[model samples]
Target chain A: MSILKVNNLSVSFKQYTSGLRQTTHQVISNLNIELVSGEILAVVGASGSGKSLLAHAILGILPLNAETSGQITYDGEVLTSKRQEQLRGKEIALVPQSVSYLNPLMRVGSQVRSSVRKRNAKQAQEEVFQRYHLKKEVGNMYPFQLSGGMARRVLVSTAMVSGASVIIADEPTPGLDKVVIEEALNNFREFADQGCAVMLISHDIESALKIADKVAVFYEGTVLEVAPVEDFEGKGDRLRHPYTQALWRALPQNDFTWIEGSI
Target chain B: MRWQLTWNIVTFLFWKAIKMASLLVAISFISFLLVKNSPIDPIQAYVGADMLNVSQEQREKIEEYWGLNQPVMEQFMSWSSAVLSGDLGTSMIFRLPVSEVIGERFLNSIALMSVAWVLSGVIGFSIGILAAMNTGTWIDRMIKWYCYTLASTPTFWMGLLLLIVFAVWLNWFPVGMGVPAGVLAEDVTIMDRIKHLILPALTLSIIGVANVALHTRQKLIEVLSSDYVVFARARGEKGFTLFWRHGLRNIALPAITLQFAAFSELFGGAVLAEQVFSYPGLGQATVEAGLRGDIPLLLGLVLFSAIFVFVGNVIADLIYRVVDPRTREGKSYAVKQ
Candidate 1:
């Protein structure tokens, strides 16, 4: 059964124009996807394809000016804003993209521990830190004291200790070295193997294909096709969407070809 | 490493002291130069034009006695050296030591300004947070309008208007002066002093609140939209928890710096408010000293005002260090290397 399901989701922003005039710009439309238990669904798309917006929409953390339509279901129930608030950071957690998302004023350890729902939050946080290769003393350090890799590990640690069943990581591997990227992806794989759902949003198709059980090709705010990981092999024909086939062919190991037109 | 950090702090303070000393000398020299070049004669103002029967010998004697016969540079050197030794020159008009005259009024001004500062800071920050939280709502628009209107109103005019309404029209507060006549300093009740203080304090505080509210509102809005705040909201932190823990904490350092930047304006507003209320504070004394061409007293007041501004800046820097651990960590890291 699907742990999370989004159906025909649309997001538009209302903005004021000259004088009393108003305009609505639809950024995302008719987007649908699902995450099953013990599976990793990676949403792969180019920049400005509204990949991050989908994650934000799922989390119900969109800006006040944004208006969203359609339905998101979690655990077979309609996920309203109230349910989003209730489940967020408990049943569902986000691993944010920007390192600046960590509160500069807060210490690394306590920040992670603050989201722990377990009885032994401290022990859980420290164990997660150890799992992420963060030294015990690094907990006392503020976010500004952390290097790029260490900060990324800290972000992962925060999501891990949240005890949430659904983890949405938005472009978590950009700007990271190979070792850190492998570690982060391995952690997500381990998380999925434990019967929890993971939504990994990324522009890096190569990294997404590494751990993703299923790949959903996103283009122009909508999912073009959702293909199983096995179908991605020797692509072009197995991939249903032309864009996905083009994307697979564009990979350097494949034909290294280029596609025309912007999403 | 600890020793190195200590050494850094000590050297920083020593350098700050040296800079402040040189700044004081430069300010005093410039003030003296302006006073010396002015057409008004301090000695003439001192002796008074009414003393027509006084002879040239007596005038020459008075000039000699006051060391007015000395060249401008010589006079400045003597005055600066005396000031360095903690001796502010005698006031030409008051016929008392400048220090004593300033000392009497300094406390009163500090008391008045302290009250205004604290009141405005609390009220303004609260309103700014509220406005930021309710952005695009009627409450936010109302507060924005109120801040702009209050900020544009002149300090003296606001003081007079408040005086008329609260003191004259309603007879709720004293119209002028810091204290009522025949009220001894030791015998004055807190309530009595508060009644006398309300008008000037209110006038000064209105401007401060308006300025701080506008600045803080803008800053809070920026902070609330910052990446960390968004992340915090995603973490399920809501409302006041999100506001004070993340929003207010991030905006505090900038807000403090902005407050210090507005110190000069605050000082000017305090002076005008004091003048309008006839409050016997340093500001009132400053104007009296300037009008009478009391060169020694005016120079002393100028130096004091400059020192106050410098101290405000130093306090702001200290608060920044306390609020931001990054600054402290950077210092330690630098010292380690």
Candidate 2:
């Protein structure tokens, strides 16, 4: 069964000014996607490609300015019109791009423990605490005491603790060192192995290629292509679409091939 | 290594406190000595025709008894010695021991200032956190405008307005002063004093609360923008729990430090507000001494005020250390005396 189905989804943000004309900026337009249990879907795009917004719509955590339309079905339930908030921390969990998701004043272990204890079985909670290598006292130490890698681990663990069947992670590896990125990718894989659907949003094509079973390239607030990772190998020139071809070539080749005149 | 560093910090702070205390005492001595060196004598003001017609010997004896006939340096040294020995000398105008007079009034001012301090700190800090949590919304804008207006307006004017509304118009309690006359400490009920105190304390504190609110708002806003606050939000922190538990804990250090500084200011600012309301407090007594040129009384009050400032800052540092233990252990940490 498809864990989550997002059909023809479009989201816009309203901008207002006292004496100036206001406008609506479409952030995500007519986006169609599916996430099945035990699968990893990578959403790849250049910065400002609205990959994060798509994940937010799926998680039902979009900002107030966002006006969303179209159908979103989660776990065979029609997720339309009704607020999608109640599904969060239970049916779905989000790993945001920024590390600021954890309260800085709280200990890493305590926050993560609380996240899972709210919805998790007690046995699973203890297993998670041990798997994360979190000391009992670590839960008492505030966020400032943690390093960047520790923070990322805490965030992922928090999502895992929620016991959501689907986890949406946005740019999980950005600004992290190679070691931290490897750890995060491994953690995502572990979540998928547990029969949970995982959505990895990224701006880096290489990183997306490494872990994604299926890659969805988003451009101009819409999905341009969705294909298996093997399909893109040596087929960059025959991408059939100008935007897709541009994105393929935009990959860092050590020769500085910058895509021009393409959004 | 950490223990050694901590030991060094403690030792450094201990010496620093001693140095500051000695410097303060020396400065007080020098300034008062200069006043004693001045040529003018108060006995001249007291000498009337009856005393003038008296023998020169009697006048000289009178000066001797008052210790005015002593050498300037000797008189200054005696004053300093007495201060060191805990005798602040008798007030020339009030004819009472300066320390005794201050002791009687100190508690009343502290009572007013402490209440105002805690009231403003708690209210302003909470509001600031709330305002920051819902930033960019109407609630945030409302808090911003309210804090801005209160911070800019004069505290005295706010006090007067509160007095007019709560006292003159509403008749909620006694108008001006801490308590009504003939309301003895034993005879007056606790509720009566509280009712009487409500207006002045509220009046004096509102502006302070506003000032604190702005500081707390700014602190919370900065904290919320940090990568960590985003983490908390993602974890499902919402409403008052988010504000108090997450936002408050993060922004508390600065807010608490500001509150401590505000305590010192409370007493200093209370002089005008207290006088306006005819409150029989230390601030009012200090003003009376200033007007009468009561040097001993004035110096005594100034010392007491300085002590309050010093103690306030020390308390603030202690509280900060308690709240954030990392501050005391890190390289960038500030050690308090």
Candidate 3:
């Protein structure tokens, strides 16, 4: 069953192009996607493809200068700003892209614990930290004291500890090593297996496919194709869109072809 | 690791103390030069009406009594030794020990400055938060206008305007002085002292409020837009809960640093405000000492103020360590690793 749905969504920002001149740039236009229980929907795109904007829209954390028009629903109810506020961190949690998102002033342990509203916060935090391969002492450290990999693990642990039904993890594995990356992906896979939905936003479609049940190909601020994970196996034969086929072939293990401008 | 970190911090504080001592010595020597080289004749300034009546020999004797007859280096050495021996010498204007006069004046000044410091910090920080939360609205614009106007205002002119409006026009508070004349000192109540204090304190605080408010507002705006704060909001934090947890803690370090940076400005304003009101505080004494060529009293006030500002800065640094983990733990931990 679908836990979250976005229909005919559009996101634009009012920015100053030059002195005394303001222009509205549409970042995401008429986009559509859904997140279902017991599934991972990987959003794969190059940078600036509006992948993060979708996450921000779903979380209702877009900047003040943003202008958004969309019908977003969670659990069959319209997710208005007020409704989004109510569900955020309880029913939905976000693992943000940048490691800088961790509060520098707060201890990593306390930061993870603050998100746990239903269960024993300390216990939940400790459990997540242990599972994420973080040393118990790492919890007592501030964000600045953490290595890049440690900070990424802490960000992932914050969402994992929240016990939210929907988790949005964005570009969360860049600084991590192979072993840690696999563990993080496996954690998300296990998290989705417990009848919760996961939206993994990434540029690395290769790693995303290891766990993502369905992959949504993002291009030019919109979803060009969202196919089951199996459909991404072969070359241009199975994939519906030319952009999606091009993306698959462009991977080094495949054709490594260049289409130019589609991305 | 923690033990090593603690030792590093202890060493850091020891070095800071040595630095402060060196700074104080430099400040004192510089102040002595400024006072000694000035055009005013200390004896003439001290004697006032009696200067013409004193014989040349008596004038020489008076100069000898104050060590002014010695070589410049000799004068400085004798003064330094006297200071080392715990004597700040006699005030040429007051005819009493400099320390005693400074103590009495400092009590009154401390009350005025302390009140102004706290009032401005609380008031400025609140308006800053208000403006940040209401950015681009009329409320923010109004607060910005008020802070900018106050920022450009002179403390003395502001004091005079407040005096005219509150004392002359309104007759709500006292016109000047710390106490009402002809009233016995024993009979003066706390309310009387507070009433006299209100104008000068308000003048000093209004000037101080502008810098803190503008800086805090700008900092909070940046903090609110930061990725950490945005992530905090995404985690179901909103309203005062969000602000209390994320907003206040993040902006507090900058706010405090800015507040403490205003310490020198606070003293400068106090001098002007005290002059405008004729308040018998250390600021008034400072001006009196400077103009009357009372080197001992002037030097004493300068040293006292330097210590005062140093203590304030130390307190701010301690608070920063408490409120910000990066300053205390991050650098040391990074070093250890």
Candidate 4:
């Protein structure tokens, strides 16, 4: 069953050019996507393709200047702003893109513990940290004291300990080593296997495809294709959109050829 | 390593002390030179025309006694040595020890200014947070307009305007003065003193409140848009929790520094306010000493003000260390590394 659905979503920002003169620029237009129970759906796109905007919109965290039009349904009910606030951090958690998302003044353990909805929040946070191979002492450290990999793990643990049914991991694996990235992906897979859903947004398609059940190719603020993972194999012939095929063929393992146009 | 850290802190404090002492010396010398160069002679003002026709021998004795006959450098050396030895010299106008006069007035100024500072800080911070939370709304625009208007108005002008509206026209508060005349310090109740204090304190606080509010609003807007705040918002934090837990904490250090900067202005405002209101504060003493060409009293006031500013800065630094763990740890550990 689809746990989340977004239909005909469009986002535009109003900017003032001069005194009392304004213009609206549309960034995302008529986008449609869905997340099902026990699935990892990765949305892959280049910079400026509005992949992050989709996650923010779903979380109801779009900037005030942005105007969005869409029908978003969660759990078979309309996901109103009130409902988004209600579900956020309790039922739907996000692993934000920037490590700076960790509060500089707060300790890592408390930050993770703050997101836990379970009774034994401390135990859950420690367990998450142990799973991520973080030292016990690391819990007392601030964000600045942690290395990049450790900070990323802390962010992931914050979401993990929330016990949310749906997790949105936005570019969570950058600056991480190969082993850690694989471990994180496996954790997501294990998480989804327990009947929760995951939306993993990233530009690194190769790593995303490693665990993604479905891949949605985003280009120019709209989804070009949402295809099964198997379709991404073998010279990109099965991929429906030319942009998706070009994206696949341009991979270093495939043709190593550059796509002609800039995003 | 622990010993080394302690030693570094000790050395840092020692250097600061030495720097303050040198700055005080420079301030004293400059003020003395300015007073000496002025057309008003302390002896002429002190003796008055009644004593002007006294014997030349007696005049020489007075000049010699006051060390007015000495060269400028020698005069400074004598005065500085006297200051170092705990003698602030006698006020030529009041004929009292400069320390005695300053000590009495300093307490009064401290009472007035501290109350104003606390009042302004609380009101300004509350308004700033409210304004930031409602950015682009009419409330925010109105606060911005009020702050800009208050900031552009001169301190003395604002004081007089408040005096007119609240004290003279409405008859709500005392027009001026720290306390009622002939009222014994022990006889006056806190409420009576507050009644007298309301107008001057309010006058002194308006500029500070406006300044703090504007700065806090600007800083909070930036901090609210920061990545950490957005992340916290995504964690289901809203309203007061978001502001108190995240917004205020981030804005605190900068706001405190700005508060300390505002304190330097308080002394300047206090002088005008005290004169306007006939308040017996350090500012009034300063002005009287300057007018009377009382070099010793003027020098003492200048040095006191300089030290006050320096101590305020030091306090700000210490508070920063307490509130910000990053700064505390970085200074200690990074130095060792």
Off by over 4 Å in 1: A260-263, B1-8, B182-187, B331-337
Model 1: which residue pairs collide?
none
List ranges where model 2 is wrong by over 4 Å: A17-21, A80-83, A117-126, A132-137, A250-263, B1-81, B125-146, B161-172, B175-196, B217-244, B251-254, B325-337
Across B236-256, the per-residue lDDT of candidate 4 in tens digits comes to 888888877788888878788
Using lDDT as the measure, name the better of candidate 2 and candidate 3: 3
Clashing pairs in 2: A100-B227, A100-B230, A100-B231, A101-B230, A101-B231, A101-B232, A102-B231, A102-B232
List candidate 3 segments past 4 Å from native. Answer: A18-20, A133-138, A233-235, A260-263, B1-9, B64-69, B331-337
Candidate with the larger TM-score of 2 and 4:
4
Candidate 2 CAPRI level = acceptable
Against the true structure, whose DockQ is highest?
3
Instruction: List DockQ, one per candidate, in order.
Output: 0.58, 0.26, 0.66, 0.49
Ranking by lDDT: 3, 1, 4, 2
RMSD of each predicted structure = 2.2, 4.9, 2.5, 2.7
What is residue A79's positional error in candidate 2, in angstroms? Answer: 2.6
TM-score of chain B of each: 0.92, 0.83, 0.94, 0.92
Which candidate would rank higher by lDDT, 1 or 3? 3
- lDDT (Cα, tens digit) per residue for candidate 3, span B23-141: 88899899888888989788898888888899999999999897787888888888888998989989888889999999999999999999999999999999999999999999999
Q: Candidates' interface RMSDs, in order?
A: 2.5, 4.9, 1.8, 2.9
- Find the candidate with the highest lDDT and give its number: 3
| Tens digit per residue, CA lDDT, model 2, B134-178 | 788899999899888987877678778887887889888787766
Worst 10 residues of 4 chain A by lDDT: A254-263
